[model samples]
Target: MIESISRRKLTVTQQLSASFLLVILIGSLLLSLPLMHNSNAPATTYLDHLFNTVSMVCVTGLSVVPVSQAYNGLGQLTAMLLMQIGGLGLVTLVSLSYYSLKQKMTLSDQSLLQSALSRSNSSGLRPYLFFIYKLTFCLEGVAALILMIDFIPRFGWGHGIFNSLFLAVSAFCNAGFDNFSTTSLTAYATNPIVNITVAFLIIAGGLGFANWLDLVRRFKAYWLEKPRHFKLAFQPLSIHTRLVLYTTATILLLGTVSGWLLELNNPGTLARLNPFQQGMVSFFQSVTMRTAGFATIDYQAANKSTNLLYMLQMIIGGAPGGTAGGIKVTVAALIFLLFKSELKGQKQVVFRNRSIPQALIRQTLTILIFFFLALLSGYFLLLITEPKLDSFSLLFEAISALATVGVSMDVTPNLSTAGRFIIMALMFFGRVGPITVLLSLLNKPEKNIRYAETDLTIA
Candidate 1:
């Protein structure tokens, strides 16, 4: 029975992986049409179109061509739709559709939804789906309103409103696809309104739906007048939620301060800005590092230390079940705690006074190893494909693609066709995950024979 269930789960994960690939393929075809290109812009190759589509659908946001120059109004709109669908998993949209039609979800559907959303269970799936849609739109609506406050006056109503809508969705979805073509958030680097609004949107989206739902429930319970309700309200957050929140806050804080310090004297990036502007850029980049791909300054022009810093941040990425991608903040935190515990000679790994299962630790280790291997393999392949590229930037690009954090050092556009294809594969694997891809290809075979345990030596 247990083996059957494991195989079933692996099947579900495979389905999810296949679903994302299909979405990207369809999106690429749509984007490759001649009608999608701007009138004055040069026609884009199918490979470029495929790369862009995968980047957008995966919500990684790296592009070979500047978005404004590569596509017309129609292409831009299509890209936005793809970003929304990708950021919110396909299962999420499907569940919403079923709820809208007043249809019940089958057991298989529930299992897929649970797996996609990384939820603990499928109880109250409908309400959760409803909440996700409501929260997403609400946040995007507010972000758009705030962004329009500045864009409308400068670009006029039509362009301003459109830009506001696109950016709000991009930020909230952590897609990082800026229509600005050239400058990105650099133009608004010192603008408190745009920076603060976008930062909030990125952080909120990266928090994951589960965290928001838990926070809302806890908040409502705390305000309840009934003793029973109050008692429920005062209950502490789940270990997952707490760990995500704590680790996210710590990452943002450290990233911001470190980025600011590293770039303070470098005239190429932040040194020219005023103190306030520098601080804003620092804070904005920090929020964006593990999540969105928006940039206020040219990261390539920054000091080597800063580039390495950003690379590490991108590798860590955002929380699971959120729009952001990476190994996930929780996984990284758990690994840290595990290492700390081991160093202290403890047998059982514990966090927040709760013991973590050995299975989870093993899972984290497996993911880390997979991530490193993928990064290393991609780096070597990229080197062979683009022999003239710098090793540091090449490695940075590989890691960014694998983590699905789309910040680039200007190397992506110059890559060979093979390099681009390699990146597309990395982005897809990163978005879905290494384990999911592996499981999608393998059959889980059950072994009935038992073997005696053997001890292995380790350092």
Candidate 2:
């Protein structure tokens, strides 16, 4: 009976969603401990703790309190652990460990793993997961080392090491929580080592684990003195990879230029900095706006255009099946591709020389529709609950928190309890994903009788 139960089939989305929910519940309890509270043992409300816990576990850096000032060492460490687990993905870890332990992987387990990694049932999947683990550690270690150079000299070795590790995990996970204040990086805003290191780590992590796996395989094959069979052996990047890279590049470039153009005139923020520092700040903002929430400038003081640009960046966000969140880069790319294909009068939509599956297109559309609705609904609810807040800031906060982007207008802490709950739900749904949660709640669809094809035109 037990063996049969273990072998029973489950939808990949359902399993992943359930796993995330379980993690959230467990995390909430863990974070609510008195030890996790600050020195004053300030009256900790259950809902606040729950919201913060969910945010951390979702890898969304939105917080009701200033994280650096509110949490003690234990709480901070707990938050970091939650972010790492959430970023790595609960389902991916289970699947990796199952295979590593030489245990039999059930069909359900395999399906979940494939979904988590956004890969098909290819023979390379296992090796890909192993390589992902190795790649993540190596990249994170290098990022930590580079960041430590900036941190250690000013702060002592112990504090420096802690900050380095925290920042490394935070960057790789695309969680924007930073112990460093605006004042902290102000000194090193133009420091090449700090900017490049963090940027590299964020981009690498944002690229998604599947891309890392492909690059690793290609590099290993090339380095092993393998015969160069260009046409037969070379594996081109998949459609998902191409979409992510193109969209991310376009957004980053445009965001940086637009930010620079808009903010160069702001006397308090950008105008004070030298031209080089201004450019660096703009570039860093562009890179970090997507999902990594580290800010070199005070977001509250950013000009109107820059704020709007950052909000747009937060909405498009990073790639699928990775730590970063939002509607996802691929989803936005697909929408664009679909529009272009329609304009060209093409029957089928194609990306990277391959036809995108209709199911995927439908899924992407569903995600976008639900995501926008959720954001708007959350925003409206917040507006009603906290009527005193600025509408634009509230809207930005709602979308950012819901999408797990973590970019804020610096109003997170002032939100009411109801507002916090709404944001928490958004973070939870965003991290587990709309499609996954929808699938879990709805379960597998039953087959329907076939009907004659008919066309109905509207619009």
Which candidate has the highest lDDT of all? 1
| Candidate 2 lDDT, 77-171, residue by residue in tens | 88788788788877667767777888877565666676677665646678888877888889989899988888899677988988888888888
| Cα-based TM-score, every candidate | 0.92, 0.88
Give lDDT per model, in order.
Answer: 0.84, 0.76
Against the hidden true structure, what lDDT does model 2 obtain? 0.76
How well does model 1 score by local distance difference test?
0.84
In terms of TM-score, the best-performing candidate is 1
Q: What TM-score number comes out for model 1?
A: 0.92
Over 4 Å off, model 1: 1-10, 225-235, 434-457
